[model samples]
Target: MASEVVALVNPNTEAALPFATTLQLVVGQATEKGRKSQNEDAIGIRIPSGLALITKGVVSVISDGVSTAEGGAHASAISVSNFLADYYSTPESWGVQTSSSKVLTALNRWLYGLGQDYRDARRGFVCTFSALVFKSCSVHMLHVGDSRIYRFRHGELLQLTHDHSTNINSSNQYLTRALGMDVNLDVDYKTLSVEVDDVYLMTTDGVHDVLTEFEIHQKLTVLCQQHSTLSDDLCEQFCLMLNKKAFDLGSKDNLSSQLLSVSQLPKQAIDDVYQSLSSQPFPPPLSVGMKLDGYQVTHTLHQSQRSQVYRVVNDQGEAFCMKTPSVNYIDDAAYIERFMLESWIGQRINSTHVVKVVELQKIKSALYYVTEFLSGISLGEWLTQHKKAPVEEVLLLLKQIELGIRAFHRRETLHQDLKPDNIFITREGVVKIIDFGSCYIKGVAEISSPLTRDRILGTADYTAPEVILGYQADGRADLFSLAVIAFEMLAGQLPFKGKLEKCRTRQDYQRLDYISVHQLNPMVPEWMDNALKKALNIDPNLRQADTCELIHQLTTAKANQTVKDFVPLIARNPVRFWQVISIALFLCLVASLLNN
Candidate 1:
């Protein structure tokens, strides 16, 4: 495999102000090459305001150096990265038109001059360059040499830059264009409209020479499924995987890849465009005389930040919850998609333990989702009113919750956020797990934003250890959360408590301790104690692998009683205790008299 590096830039250009653009670069060499032969360098700059001559948006640049029979490649690459970083850091004197292009040309000349001054320069410490500049609705890319730039849209691949290499026969090659090759350079530049879900990739020959474009595309698709946030760690992993793939194919040269993804359309411009498109008159609310599809919105049930839930009645007078995006989010395409996804996933998962979605509806100016209305109190209210249920009852309720979660896990889904409020219990003792809003289908993880990692999605107290550590959460994380809820149910208090209002940070959760629950509830059985301990283990690997095993142990242990349950006969009744003592004293007196 060949080593690859990937990154994602925020689509909200306004919000991405400080950095304006993001950059990532990685370099890899075969094990046979003992020392670092080449270096990867990256630079990012925010184009100053009023610089219309230059691009007004962000400019990101990356370079990968490759040298044969010389050690200057590493130094040359680092020098260029540092120089560009400094040049872009200050206010630019040149405007957007040619300011950026001019700056790059100057850098190119500097590299050429440096190479001419050194003896090893004759061999040429050449480097491939790729840069992305965002202005208004478009992105411009400049490229040279074997360093490549690729664009992906809707699962299709487009190679944006062609390699500049002269083939002598089959294997021997000479560079046609590169920075530091001569006193002058011929750079390839292209401009195109930037759209949401578009991804750009740039890499050194190390990546392209080893892994085919198809192979690189496949790995990117896989990585997108597991991660929504892009980081240095993820980039490193991508690079390592590529290098591994390249080595397997017998590549002996250095390798590197840089990937940048555009997750969302420019939010402001896109929102404005969507609003303009949806400028039609709103139809009057459905009246008693008119029908919408087949059901009537009998009344509006509730309204929240993102959407509204309505109480609807079918022609037969059956009730259902019809949810529609709030007017504010009506033009918000991303929110609409998320709402639809939640409804879709909820409908796919049909279980008594989960809330059910009946159907999805799209009307003028709005999208609606119909679901079954749950008639019960939320677990949060139940906990507050009941304080704590009997230990046995708590155990039974926990078993029910665990079984419900197991059902989801079996379907290869993980409820990313599970908490008391999202769970409900009817008066008839039926448990319904509600809120698939934060639920994620297993094996599909990538989303639009890399900043998603910074946003904590679930309730603080219930998040798992792995989640806190910024790892991809699975069914085991859910089990850890369920264990916390179990502990709270038995102890009448959370396992972790502090002055903080919520356990949002890992530090807030350090207060959790197993002994605390045991101290509060002495009636807790030894078997139950051990089960909770194992379930709440900080290390996910040490925790119970399956929730089914936990349920079985708790049920079986409840059935069996051991010596630990025994109490002295005298302790059961004080009067019986006195009589037994008196009889013992009389027997002792009789023995003494007989002996005399």
Candidate 2:
């Protein structure tokens, strides 16, 4: 059952830089069934492309099924296959630890359930599992049983994972933990930074138990010294030689070894990235009655420093909005790339509450994208029209906007720049989110790029404090932004009232005052105001966990109390508070004058 399957290719775009800092891995593996009835070892690897590479990362797994198991080979195959498939399917919003752990836990429980059906554990599905995930600039390892992951770098060999076994004897050891050994499973996890030209090795106990660490170190050192970079074929030969040496040392177990050498890492240079992004000539700004690629420009819709939007109609008389990149960024490819990304995101996200990208059937002459023309007013305009809108109506629009935000979150994306100007209120009372130029996709963010957008892209007043402080933004950041919109919709004003701009530090953010929603708009109930406060907390940690939680609280009714009960008199009515103090002082002065 031994098979030769090697060469896990990194599918990200090839670096144009001569000295790129991107990760490029060359992989090779060899497996053997040395004197065994069937090979019970499995190996698998995945190198994702583009955004997936950043979000899900590259993975390599090795498993060794217990010989005592009835279907040992099947167990090994299932363990490796299921893990790789499920790991990629996990939510991108989650960190590697959370995503990988959840997948492994579910897989472990399933394996255990299958084993519990058997009278003897040995007859059930059982396997040792070890996996390595290469993500960002770090390597994450997960292991159970006796399978191992190793790193060989700079003429030194380092064991990355500990074996989950106890020595019954020198010749016979017992697995203390495995995938199907019990209902509860404990998987060892570790993370380490990665450097270019580093070699990673994954092996079964069949090879590691027989070869001493010193011998393994010597062989790897010699290979490294002989060649700066080993070819795929040479790596495969080295792995097979290790297996053969172990077999010659009186080991009869099935053996497997996988080797991965990082050849390149993403370069910090921006020139190449800019060249790639600005390859296309910037489209000329279209004016009214102009024609381009059979689309007649009817009128200019919107204009900004980044791009220009025009209402256009094709020969078929179908109306659409053509968005073209601004000439200001004709040489700035990173900005152009982001401008194009907005259209890409618009096309993928399918929701009535989100703008839809019009499919371009014919080749375009310039760098422009077309989307369905929306016959609706912007949320900003709607807010201006209804300064004191009813709470029920505002909630309806907010709920729809929340749905649109959810669509982004479900795909592990965040609309980093969510404001009233980016929201649309249709003539039919539908709310839709527009402008994905500032969106952040977790997977896309991981892939190394020359263009750095480390600063916050959102409006400070509506953006989460964490984002403004140059911290990584998650779905909670979007929640905070949405809460700001909701607060504005209900109260016709911001909660903090420009206080965020003054918040240069975390302490400043914490000290900022929260004005009660009811004080501005008595129409909003106390519960709704409290809910908005929780969602709009300056600290992301103090905010609601998710949109669902916030929406639930917003809809939940609580006992109505006086606004003064929750808000200070000075904050609620500053003028009235000062007037009361003045009157009291004047009364005391008049009484003193009468006594004199």
Question: How many clashes does each candidate structure show, in the order listed?
Answer: 22, 7
Whole-model lDDT values for every prediction: 0.60, 0.79
| Residue-level lDDT for 305 in candidate 2 | 86
Q: Candidate 1, residues 320-349: lDDT per residue as tens digits?
A: 876665666554544544454566566557
Q: Residue 107 in model 1: shift from native, Å?
A: 58
For model 1, the superposed segments whose C-alpha errors exceed 4 Å read 1-302, 330-332, 360-365, 443-456, 498-508, 558-596
lDDT for each residue of candidate 2 in 436-474, tens digit (9 for 90 to 100): 888886655554454655343688778888888888788
Which candidate wins on lDDT? 2
lDDT of 2: 0.79
Candidate 1 lDDT trough over 10 residues, lowest sum? 10-19
